[model samples]
Target chain A: MRVVYDGTFEGFLTIVYELYYQKLKPTVIEKSALSYSLFDEVDTLVTDETKALKVLQGLQKWWSRKNLQTILNTFMCDSKSFEMDLLKFIRLGFKDEKELQNINHTSVFAIRNLEKEFFRHYHRMTGFVRFQELEDETLYAKIEGKFNTLYYLGEHFSKRFNNQKFIIHDIERGLAFVHNQESKGIHQVADFDEPIYSSKEEKFLKLWKTFFKSVAIESRTNPKLQQSFVPLIYRTYMSEFG
Target chain B: MKKDIYTKMQILSDSAKYDVSCSSSGSDNNYKTGELGATENSGICHTFTADGRCVSLLKVLLTNYCIYDCAYCMNRVGNDIPRAAFSPKELADITINFYKRNYIEGLFLSSGIIYSEDHTMELILKTLRLLRHEHKFNGYIHVKLIPGSDAKLIDEVVKLASRVSSNIELPSNKSLKLLAPNKTKEKVLQPLKLARDISLERTDKVIGMSTQLIVGATPESDRDILQLSSALYDKALLKRVYYSAYIPVNNHKNLPALVNKPPLLREHRLYQADWLLRFYGFNWSEIVNEANPNLDEELDPKTFWALNNLHLFPIEINQASKEELIRIPGIGVRGAYKIIAARRFKRLGFDDLKKLRVSLKRARYFITCRGKYQNEVALYPEKIRYALLEPAKPKQPTLFDINYSATTGEL
Candidate 1:
């Protein structure tokens, strides 16, 4: 069976419970609109607060509260092989509370790998994510990330520039958040079509690019290492490379 | 002078690139009223390159003109190569410009011997002093102490700089004579000892000293290197010891012909072993013996250590003390702490370890729950070694696996 969730963690947990009750082996559990499977029987699951809370309690019984939170973070972030590995972890969690502790050992190495990946991306974003000052004097940023890390990113940006008014847009996911000098909140927005950059913005980018190129040692150029650190995909948005 | 500066900077910096301990950590002090910039003690990490080398500082050389012809050094004076030297002012200007743009954290300046030991030392000291006093640059400066430099000069450089280092080049004095006749064991050791003593005396703003040794250069075994490192750590009070795998840059009658790449893997193993010695409560003798100078090419130092000490396996996860927990193959210092913190609230078993995300495959052989895996069939050391060393084949991804999106945007 294939299950389509509401792109929400609670909705996925509801599917987990449904699979357990029905004793059905799910071939795929994906977010709504993302599933393209035709052969498998698909069930669209709605978010159930009660059922989600029960699952969270069951997970807490076996694993410590902190570990359970990490697993939940993995699930919400939509980690690779999360569904299969999480199901196996849940099964083990029930057999022995110790089984949940051993989640690091399971064949599904996705969770730990995902944690490193997320932290690495987060670290890169700290340095690489650039904000441009608009004609209106408000800062704007456009990012193209594979994961829905907008919430976490907002927390970082808000703290980094406390007094500045800024808007960060996730172009791929079509989600964005705005933080003004007075208030801090996260809200979903439809597609944004902003005007082209002013001449001053273009000049600053050119200067930044020049500065970047000038600083690197030509003799010590290691393109392989540079590519490994900042992948070609991220180069699309980086002011120096783009 | 400008051309001299550029050529020398390129040669010396390129030569110094292989030395992996260029960290600019400790004490944060910025320029008050000078030309430009300041230093933050947290040590800014500008970027990590493909080879995983951190580019925090402007790692370069003051001159590539050397008096000693070390076989492993590309800039050896006898080698038929172009030479260059940077005046103190030229170097200071480049550092200031780079610092202002936030391209580097600080300057990591090393040099080849120019004119004499004292002369080369004076030039380096002059550049640093200008950067600090005249330029009022407060960034973390890691100056390389020239062996045979005057004690007073070394003391002055240490006071003006955040960190000072001198390369031992080779492990033993015998190897030093064979490869670099100009430099002896005392020549390298004296400067390092002087830096250590001065740093100890002035602990307020003084950062500690570090040293590097070339691996796979001579016949000295890994045991010899480790013993030397252990002594340096215990006696010299050195902050760090870096190992650079010998790359054959110069060919001479005295040097070995190019056969294989300077055992980069072996160099990496030594670093792992070094970490264990410093943090994991391991000793030099415990890691390698006289007969086995090198570590296993395949397994990490910790895994090798665990396999060698099999009798201590299957220590109860909940019961193992902090010291015993550190000995586990998969558990690091952080992992051990997590285990301790988690177990305090609940009785931890095999499943709990998985949830905690410890590398259980390596740890399983070394740990037990309720004395269960104590009498399990132990695999032959060769088989275990093969299993540990052999790289696993990449598994073909299933349709479901392919469809699954990675959380952090990485493939």
Candidate 2:
């Protein structure tokens, strides 16, 4: 019997229990769009709230709550071979609690990969995020990142600029959060239209461009090194470079 | 005009190439209004060059015009070289433009003495001040302290720069007198002492200081170099002491006739010995003696120290403390921590050591794991010396270098 899920963690956990309790053989569980076989019988599994909670509660005894959340998030990201790896990890979790702590195991590969990707994005944003001053006397930034790391990045930027009102626009994902003077809040915007620049801002940017041109040592001008830090693709959006 | 610029650049860059400490780290400054950009304490590694050097900062000299004539320096007054000077505005603009394109972490500005020591120091300080105040650039800046600059100028420079260093070109006073008559030991050490004192006083700021010593310039022994470096570290609280191997550039009557190249391997050995002093807690007397001033070029400094002190060997890895682990060859601070953490979970055997990627070739002679190992090496005093010193066959070249023609497929 083949089972189809709604591509959610709860639905997948319910399918795991159905396979175990019903003692079914030749079972395959897949997301909705992944179903292509003509001969197999497909039963679409609905997300059962109570059964999913029971399975998660049982998993908490073997793995820490944080580790379970990491595994679930990694699965929701739609990684390759995630279902098979999750199944193996769940099996190992039943066998020995110590197996959950081993990071090098194939079962925990998705969690480890997600952590690496998170740190990479965090470091890149640390260097690449540029803020521009708008005509309304507010600071603004735009980033087009692959991961949904805006909340974590917002917390970092909040700590960096506590007294300023700024907005970070996710150009690729079409989401932005406006942090006002008093508190920080998230908002979704359709797209960014270029804000009007004031005369003072234009003058300051001109002065900045002049200073940038002056500070580079002609003796040590290496474009190859420059390309490594801010790649050519990012140059089009950068004010000084443009 | 462009050819002249290129020529001056080549001369100045070649002159400034020897000083190795170019790290722009451990500071936090944000771009304010009118400034080009800002800096972060978490330093950026801009790029690695063809020579495997990390090009982090725009390391350059303000001018290639010197008053003093150091025999080993290409920019010495007697050498025939083109010279160039950038106005403070020019320097500030270049830094801003390069920073905007993300070419470098920041600026590491040095200079050949233009006129008087005070005049040169003031010019460099003005450039940095303009970059900070006028340009609003809060970036990593490392400035070189001219040997005879006024104490007040050094103080002002330190406030604007992230890190400061003074080059003590030769280790001893005798070598400084013979090669560079204008520079004395006291002149070089005085400004460094003032910078160190000020940095200590302003502990809240991100202050880092370092020094550089030219190796193989004169006949000063490696023992003298290590002793001086150790004193600088202990007394001056220096972050690093760079060793630059002397490259002959000027022809002078007082210098030795050209015979052999500068001993790069010897310089490398001194760097290792310096690292041992700084990180491994090994004293100079333990590593070197009065008679033998040079380190063994074939083996590393830590191995040499371990070979000399055989009585302290065969330490139990799991049971030994962190201090004892640091003394063993091939075991760094990180390796010791790994051993400590791994042993908490399971009893570490030879297999576990292999898994941790510890260098078994050198470390096997020094450590015992579960009180046993496979091979039985020499334990006797005389036999162990021969075993450590025996020449081994060279291994094949790495895959990165091998089959160059086939990989490139050049017709």
Candidate 3:
């Protein structure tokens, strides 16, 4: 049997809720928008918050807090067949709840690997994300991330830049994290206009570029080493690379 | 005037890059006072430059003008290079501005001795005063304590900065006399010892003290370097001892003339040994003794040691303690912990070790899973050494290589 659900994480949890109640053994799972193939028996699961909540509560009861967080982070990954992979993990998780903690398990290992990849990108963005000073003294930065990491980045920036107002726009994802002093908001930005830089911003950037150039030792200029640390894709928005 | 900052920054940062200590870790001071930034214990690398070096701290010299002429230094008084100095206000402004833009984690402020050691230290202290007291900037600030500076100035500098270091340029006293005439081993150790005492006495604001050693510049062996590092760590509570492979920056009759490139591989080997000293519970004698002063270029220090002492190998993976596991070449500090935690549930095989992040190919020859050897390779020291020395493939960056580069400020 094939199960189709909305792409949201809530939709995935509703499928987990159906596994216990409706006795639906799904052979394949696909997101609703991409579910075009005809199936002999098809179950399209509508996302119900109550059903999702029950599934989450059951996970907390049987699994662990870390496991729940791992699944949530895994859902945020942009890998192909990630939804189907999540379904496999959820099924195996409820089958033998204790097996969820075992790193040797194929499903648990796959989800944890996704979590590690997501967190690595998230942490790298935290350091690589540079803000340009706007004309109104607000800081504006944009990132094109592989995962939906803007959710984790907001807390880090808010705590660090408490006195400042800033907006971190995820260009590819079309989401922006707008942070003001003491309050933060995440909005879906349809179109973000080019930012106006402060007069001092350009000079600081020039000085930064100079500093970056000077700090590298000419005797040990290894491009391959540099590329390994700061991957080629991340240089697009980094001012130092320019 | 605005362009002057860039020009001066070029000279200052270029002169500063030779000192290979750009870590912003070891201290965990969160932004408690509504300051603009916070410091993580694991540290953060803002960016990596073309040299693959981490751009963590805004490593810069306050001034390239000096009174003493160190033979190995680019900014020595005798050298005919362009010299520049940043005023206290200019440096403090630059550090704060850079921090605001997330260009750096903190400021690593070092300077050449001008007029006197005390005078240079006072200028650095003033910059720290402005950042800490005036701007209330509570981010990571690593300052260089002038070797022969007054104790009062050292105390003041230590109180303001989050981390401090006094570069013991060359390892031995003979090398110090031959290269740096004005500085001595006692002068360098005095400040490091004082800073350690002061940091221990202070109840608030934890401070970490570190020092740098110029490797391959002098006639000091790896044993000599590691012994010095071990002493500094044990006696003065030095948090880190950085080793920079000598890059011939200036022509000097006293310095070692290198025809080839810098001793980066040798420097890398020293770092591996240094890691064993700090974390792996191995002493200087264990790493490199009087018989073998230099590390083998082919194998890593741990692998070399494992090969030298093959009698202890073929230990059961499940039965080995955490200490025994770490001594293995492939299992790092993290991998050792992972193995210890996972083996409690069931007996782990060679495949299980791979999942736990062990370097199975390297560990396979030494370790056995439940008394069953996974590989057909012999365990004899000569055969194992030759097997490891056989160049099978091009070197790819492993986790150990990344870990060493990150810890030792290598690209």
Identify the runs in model 3 with alpha carbons over 4 angstroms from their true place.
A32-43, A60-64, A88-98, B1-3, B204-206, B355-357, B393-411
Best by lDDT: 3
Tens-place lDDT digits, model 1, residues A146-221 = 5566777677556434445678777777777788857767667675678455445654455444434434533344
The number of the candidate with the highest TM-score is 3
DockQ of each candidate relative to the true complex: 0.08, 0.11, 0.56
Q: Compared with the real two-chain complex, what DockQ does model 1 have?
A: 0.08
Q: What tens digits encode model 2's per-residue C-alpha lDDT throughout B167-278?
A: 8888888888888889898998888788878877888543688888888768888888998898888874587899966656678876766835555567678888998998
TM-score of chain B of each: 0.88, 0.90, 0.93
lDDT per residue, candidate 3, B1-411, as tens digits?
344878999999988998888899988757753657778777889999877888899999999999888898888899998888999999999888888888999999999888888899999999999998888787899998888889899899888888988888889999999999988999888888888888778864346878888888887888888888998777646888888888888899998776477778888898898899889999888889889998987789999998888889877879998889888888888778767767766788987877766677687888888889855688899888877777767677786663334433343
By DockQ thresholds, what CAPRI class is model 2?
incorrect
Instruction: Give the least accurate 10-residue stretch of model 3 chain A, judged by summed lDDT.
Output: A31-40
- Order candidates by DockQ, high to low: 3, 2, 1
TM of each candidate vs. truth: 0.68, 0.71, 0.93
**Each model's C-alpha lDDT?**
0.70, 0.71, 0.83
Worst 10 residues of 2 chain B by lDDT: B402-411
Candidate 2 regions off by >4 Å? A1-242, B1-14, B28-42, B204-206, B259-262, B380-411
List candidate 1 stretches off by more than 4 Å: A1-122, A125-229, A232-242, B1-12, B26-44, B50-52, B204-206, B374-383, B386-411
True contacts kept of 3: 0.65
